[model samples]
Target: MTVQDIRAFNRFYTNVIGALDHRRHLHAPYTLTEARVLYELAHSPRTDAADLRGELSLDSGYLSRILTRFEQDGLVERAPSAQDPRRRRITLTAQGRETAALLAERSDQAVGSLLSAVPAADRARLAEAMRTIREILSAGRPPRGEDIVLREPVAGDLGWIVQRNAALYAAEFGWNTDYEGLVARIVADFAEDHDPHLERVWIAELDGRPVGCVMCVRDEAPATARLRLLLVEPDARGLGAGDRLIGAVVDFARGVGYRDLVLWTNDVLAAARRLYQRHGFVLTAEKPHRSFGKHLTGQDWRLNLTDAQQ
Candidate 1:
């Protein structure tokens, strides 16, 4: 609680930010602060100027100057707010949105690069450390820990599962739509014909938003279950969601007379591999293959439920 400790942490985090932000031309077309404003405007359309100021905690005069610059550049347009004639509304033009999207892509690339240096085993600790900092320092109440719930997939979750898998892989690994096609096929097959007794999906919700999902289904081999498509968003990571989803799958498999649980994952997914290892899964086999535009080693991991019970 001492000021010195907080100042030291601030310096440490500043270095981390510099590493991520100092990548090639992060602030070329826009300053870091201006890029942040563009990001906010991109996500929240028809927003009041004053509200934007409050949301970013920017000085009103400083924000007005930036908006003026953006207007001069034809990046955004301002109008009187419909809710309050006295207030001003801000909207990003098509050009502005394009700029914002470019900035977002650059940001994602920079983050992906920074993360590549961190070993997979250390990523969960890093994510947890960052989440703790954000939770403790943010102005509002931190996201509710008790609000997390796991439920069966509903009408739209299948689509969500496919889309999120595709988007996450694309952003993090530069994977192509071929991966999306594979996930779509798996989901479509599940939808077409899956036994209720031997197949199930769990969607992890935080604050009522789906942030993670996994599916357990009967394997081709008798008395076996396959775990597939497990994913947790960055925000939901380090919050026990992945662990919860996998635990649910294991429990259900063991409950329904399954002798073994098996999963296939690429070696690049080291964090997930670690999680599977912690749950007593053994790496049975691996082989190199070209997949999703990368040369990767595909692995088969298995957990023996009968052994687990003993």
Candidate 2:
């Protein structure tokens, strides 16, 4: 490789975030893989060992040994699966939960502080470059191949949406029961009496499997509509599901005579911000809210629908 290319990679990877990740966040007693396994367990109370095996692509023997160590340390528990006694499920103990949170919080703090130190314009450039790299890698791999078109949610789909929303938020951000319960209430309401004319739910499917979902609800606070329960599966995030979902919501809102749209999102959702901006959503306000065991700075975004997209 060219010297310039090597230097760029060194500056961005080794010299940049790598230092913080290694020095600040990587010093936990657990190995990185073990920490990731703990993270998976911390999110869902009980997850199948086979499921974890597939999710993390860990070898059966190796994973079992790691889990055994965790169990011995009172950090994790293994139980027989109800559906099949031969199968085992793994869960985090109280100590495991606390350890996972501490690790996650430290990682986030280090990354957040480092990113915050960069100038706004440079940060934007860095973000875009990271996204482009993801796109390039995705194009080369094409895990599921091509972009998936999202459709309105159908029967039984709401259940998957709730599961994905809860599991993803919990794993990614340490968001917990409160967030999941709020999503459940919204989904239950829509299932019981869904007004397609007034509200809509959309899901992105790959290989006929739902990977992402977004919903629009009629807002009572004002006459505007609120975009709620927006989520994309981590694997499918960089493939444009977010932008498509937001676009669909905004289009539906305009079609339904709503002149304004609003959404609440944590500041850590960088991709969501880019999508919102592309769809004419502007930051209107900010508030400090603490949920899921940590402080979060949330921003309110507003979109005026009078000037519709072409």
Candidate 3:
């Protein structure tokens, strides 16, 4: 949609639901921008201002002004980062937290009240459509919302990947304890000694949120690499995340002079198989494997890394 079309829709929505007016009144004490800063600080306390600046995509002077006003109003506090003396970490004060909570409650009520008229089934469809629209709009777009970035996994991203993967596998494949243990071991090994030269992890990010990840390990043989632990969040399945992850691993292997790449996966992983095949990997071996709660066939795939891959 064009800008004009979006404006027209906004106008229709505001007039019909009185949303815009209600929001203005409810947030009279603080401008939307200031309130957003408060909300971000409330959720992610002690965030560095530089990080916020990048997340919100605000000019340094403009952000400083907002923060200055907030500080004068006794709504937030700023402290020097212990790790980085130059960075100022911002956090909400008690008053700021309370105000943010009230704002959130009011906002939720406002949205819920507006949506209540829609039937449950229709609401689900609406929600799905909205999610699809958001994904389309946000493709390749940096998240510039509320001075806080929702991010994907990065090279050093920790915590959320482990938790999200465990939950995701449990929901998707009925994968349980064994899968979790395997993931735990991989994470532990990476944490203990991540050799950037020999191996690396790649993550897909949305506004900084870690949504997908893959690890590539160099093999003992002179020009070989092993791909492992590839995963993409269910919410972030589309937008070619899996493809990008595999490409990153392949590119990394090639950069390090690997002449071939290999991976092992279960037969049930149809999407992954397609991605592997798209990247020039061919299934060279298959065998029935009784493990991880199911009797399934495992496929070992290998790619001849041509000059481009090398």
Scored by lDDT, the top model is 1
Off by over 4 Å in 1: 1-139
TM-score of 3: 0.51
Q: For each candidate, what TM-score against the reference?
A: 0.55, 0.52, 0.51
C-alpha lDDT of residue 60 in model 3: 92
Candidate 2 residues lying further than 4 Å off, grouped into runs, are 1-146, 308-310
TM-score winner, 1 or 3: 1
Sort every candidate by lDDT, greatest first.
1, 2, 3
Q: Report the number of the highest-TM-score candidate.
A: 1
Model 2: lowest-lDDT 10 consecutive positions: 143-152
lDDT of 3 by residue, 83-177 (tens): 58799967666576568767766666667777888988898788777767676766756443231222223334755567777788778888777
Model 1 TM-score on a 0 to 1 scale:
0.55
lDDT of 2: 0.76
| Candidate 2: tens digits of C-alpha lDDT, residues 1-310 | 5789967887878666568877785537888788878766643222689977877899999999999999998887787875577989666655765677677677668887887889988976887787676667576657542346565555579999888888888888888788888888989998888665578787877645688888898887666899988888877867777776776677567655788999998898887788888778899999998886679998999998886342
lDDT of 1: 0.82
Q: After superposition, how far is residue 244 of candidate 2 from its true place, in Å?
A: 0.8
Please identify which of the two predictions, 1 or 3, would achieve the higher lDDT against the true structure. Answer: 1
lDDT of 1 by residue, 1-310 (tens): 8999999988997887786776568756678889888876754332579877876889999999999999999888887865687988777766776787678778777877888999999988987886666666655565653345676666689999999999999998888999999999999999999986678788888655699999999999889999999999989888777877887787667655799999999999988998898788999999999989989899999999997232
